[model samples]
Target chain A: MSAHLTEIIVFSVLFLLVSGMGFVAAKWRAPTDMAHLDEWGLGGRSFGGWITWFLVGGDLYTAYTFVAVPALIFGAGAAGFFAVPYTVVIYPLFFLILVRLWSVSHRHGFVTPADFVRTRYDSPTLALLIAITGIVATMPYIALQLIGIEAVLKTMGVTGDSAIARHLPIIIAFAILAAYTYQSGLRAPALIAFVKDTLIYIVIIVAVIYLPYKLGGWGAIFEAADKKFQASPAPGDGIILNANNQVQYFTLALGSALALFLYPHSITGVLASRNRDVIKRNMSALPAYSFLLGLIALLGYMAIAAGVKPLPGAKPGSVDSNTVVPLLFDLHFPPWFAGVAFAAIGIGALVPAAIMSIAAANLFTRNIYKEYLRKDATPAQEAGVAKITSLVVKIGAVAFIVFLDPQFSIDLQLIGGVIILQTGPSVILGLYGRWLHRGALIAGWAAGMGLAFWMLWQIPNAATGRKHFGGSAFALSEFGFDTPKTIYVGFVAVLVNLAVAVLVTFLLRALKTPEGVDGTAKDDYFADEGDPRIARRLPGTVEKVSST
Target chain B: MAEPESPHADTKPRTDSSPWNWLLLVPIVVPLLTPLFNHDEPRLAGFPLFYWLQFAFILLGVVTTTLVYRMTRSRGRS
Candidate 1:
């Protein structure tokens, strides 16, 4: 009877099909016993080159990339393009940083960055801080995925005026995701990523090519964007970058590129590969998604061209930018095809949300629960805890949806960027050298975390009705500068983190504070796939399956 | 040659001691320095300089990293 029903039916069928795949994925490349963190938490860490490529690609180019990147572009204009450079730079950084992490991880069988931190710095307190930051950073990220799903539902007209009616579909989606994740762990996402990525690619290619023709041309699209921005009274809303905002764009991209891989879920994808060479090959191949992302960012401009606006009676000042892409699809594509696009967004959220929950769970099981609560957790017990923790983490993410506005979760993500960047001095820099003292790293993390919150507390978005901790853009004028320049709070906070790390390190060294022994060999950072020592740790007599 | 004095050092690849490993820094450092290429002039096909150069940098990074992987694969790991 209704036009949106065809979309609802198509989306439901695909979501059901993927849920079926999620259940069956537990047996994909089946391990003999899925009782260990390596086996359950990381898909046995046996994925070869192509599989790793899709898995990591699927994990990084998330619902955020699909929804928020375009949404931000639609809302903020060119600054939304920051995600593009961040991802472009991410591949190169991944090429360099990931293989080493893979090598060291494979050698020591380290599952989380906190595991590496504990052994590298021999500081449980420091590892605990890292683990907690990862869990906190990721919960809001998982919430953003719900926002993607919500935007899709909103466009599909499934959302009702009542709160319970609105959140019903989200609850169902997360329930399916949570059950499968609890059953399958990382395998669920690893298997579903193939479908998610394929749908995203098809939807994007078709939309990018087809949408421009539907409107006028690229020239017309650009002109419309320029006209809108030129008419808007807000500063820095134009199609081009001004001097005041260039530094913010640059630093945001650069800072986010560094922060991207440090998130536990991202590293989980990397560490799941069979070996270092798999990581290297995947690094080169993953940039192809960045190419896809560049095309996806253009969706925002297309939405503007299509004259898509927020829903009727929606506040103009508090317009949901997240709705732009789905609204674009709903208006232009046929109902069934729009359904396909919505499924793409919905499943896109599923893959990352699954993996993020798993990563957070692993950090708790190995670094927090196992390290502190139960030093004697068996492999089975550890996996058990991680499974339960994964469920708990998913529940926490869902709470973000049920309790707060979706925009609040988005702001949490920016704060997440600021907080996770604090780990760089200890994690990324430590991968190259161990010169920074453990006590110094602890001090640095506290300083970075403190400054990140303080900076966040200072940003006020008047439109969103936030007086403090409103967004990521820190006004340079806040620091008494004459100009209108703003910087990424994450970048400045990270700089403070590094400075404190260096200074405290020298002081600790001069005072001769007992720097704990480094547990790793210098050569461990360069280990490759066929290294016999590491290979022996693989499940005995289980043949390496090259399944994608 | 690589301070094999550390007892466990020889257990894994010696690729780090090779001269070419330093090249990995190029892909990382070039992209991290934002002020180096943060302009919007000379728009390519209506895309700003800030946008198009990043795609080129991605290409450059992949090539350099692939080259490093090839060069190091042949000469080191013993």
Candidate 2:
């Protein structure tokens, strides 16, 4: 069979497998009622440790990550390795943050982070802002996953060079994804993640072992990458880091770490766990992906060893690095192995895209629809709204890819990171204590968002010839700091967010502004699975509580 | 359905934390040092420090995950 035909068959099989799993997931735990948001959105809030591990791992380590990291190394050299450290740091940091979020969300029966913000800080406006930010940030990330799949399609020669012809397959794939995700809610991805992660681990393990021997060796790869980097005119292009990129490196890494857990989909994954211990266990274990990421990053070097050249006038080094893995497999492995690797990347896209749509849909259903449109909406109605919203979200991401310059998708992804970071004060800080006033949180999100946009406007990318409108993550020097030390714009923006929150809280208090009623008790933050006060109950049932 | 008990709910907080808890730092520290010890001079399998260091990290990851499971589990329950 032709390569394109083989790829199509592999993709078709994977699609059927995921859809079959989605149908089966409805019975995974056999929740009492699929109509309720809790059962559909949070998977009955009863996932055990192993299930939670695989689900969260599959959610966080995505196709965009798998494609982009190695592609980045192939394109830019050492800077691509930023993904490895960022992934490593995120888990340990989450160990500290997520346990608290799980406790607080469970206590309040919260599905989205914005729900926590609304009650904890007593501000509907702030909750709305957070919900909007999450939807906006997530859309581009979902679009970027399409980019990963497109890279594979291009390598398999399934896509013609014509713009319209190239993206038709992706559009169809996403349409199918939108349908299943909308039908099944988070359960679709949670079930599909099992297959996606298994394929990724198997392909990467075999590639790491088999590729070096097939090509010359690790030595041959490194030598070629070094030669390529040394010859490039860009300062710090080939093998190692240079002075100019260090600040960008540190800030990008740290910014990504802080922003990692802040994504609504990330919290959605964390909240689905049965208890705090699941979050804790996953945090300590998820860094295992970093080891895999390190191997994946080396594929860029492997591409260099194989003398894989970028397409003509493609900025010399910039021919879609996302294609490197697919290309590597095509060059070295037999057609069957290549088909499997392509399937791995294809399935990787579905897991996160499903989760992102579900998370975004939940944000809209809980924070927007129920909060404003229909406060008396039934559980079935809420699930219906979330299902429709997920379809709209997937369609919107597809439109983003179809309409805009592909590079804009990357910038938008970074902007999403900065935008979601605005929620740190409300979500992360609120978990520990509710000291900051809700109004202050709103003002802080505004100021931080404004500053992040202004800083992003200053970065310029030379390759795209896109000036003053490039990367969204900012370097500290732009803020007039003299030291070599640079922090993520999100980190800086979040600092401003916290400062405004704290300062405004004091001012509001001094003015005798009402702090508003807290709907939860202080002890609820420490409640666990069997806490009779906080346990999940049948829909439409109510439990009496002793007034504190 | 029966009420599922929280595993750590009744357990007392660790009064004397093990030094082993610090082993969590190994994955983070080792990866960072791999670049520094890389010496910019490439070698393979003889003193292939880069590859060896990364392999060591995989081992470190296995050890840390096992340790975390042991530390978090109940003394008698497991």
Best by lDDT: 1
The TM-score each candidate achieves on chain A is 0.96, 0.93
The TM-score values for the models, in the order shown, are 0.94, 0.89
For residues A1-548, what per-residue lDDT tens digits would candidate 2 score against the true structure? 27467666876787777877876777776765687788778887778788788788888888767777776788777767767666765765576557666776786678998988787777888889989998988998899888878777878877755667868989888887877776677788888888888888999899888878877777777778878888878664655665556556656666787787889888888888987667767766776777787887888888888878644322344456567778888878777778888988988888888888889999999999999999877677888899899889988988887777764344566778888888888888887777888888888889999888777778777667777767753555666877554345676778888898899989988998888866555555656676655555664342122111
Error of 2 at A208 (Å): 1.0
TM-score of 1: 0.94
Give me the runs in candidate 2 sitting further than 4 Å from their true place.
A1-3, A161-163, A311-318, A408-410, A473-477, A480-487, A539-548, B1-78
Clashing pairs in 1: none
lDDT (Cα, tens digit) per residue for candidate 1, span A230-337: 888878886766678878887888888888879999999999988777777776677789888888887998888889896532334467778888889988999999
State iRMS for model 2: 6.5
Error of 1 at B51 (Å): 4.0
Retained true contacts (fraction), each candidate? 0.33, 0.09
The true-versus-predicted C-alpha distance at residue A314 of model 2, in Å, is 10
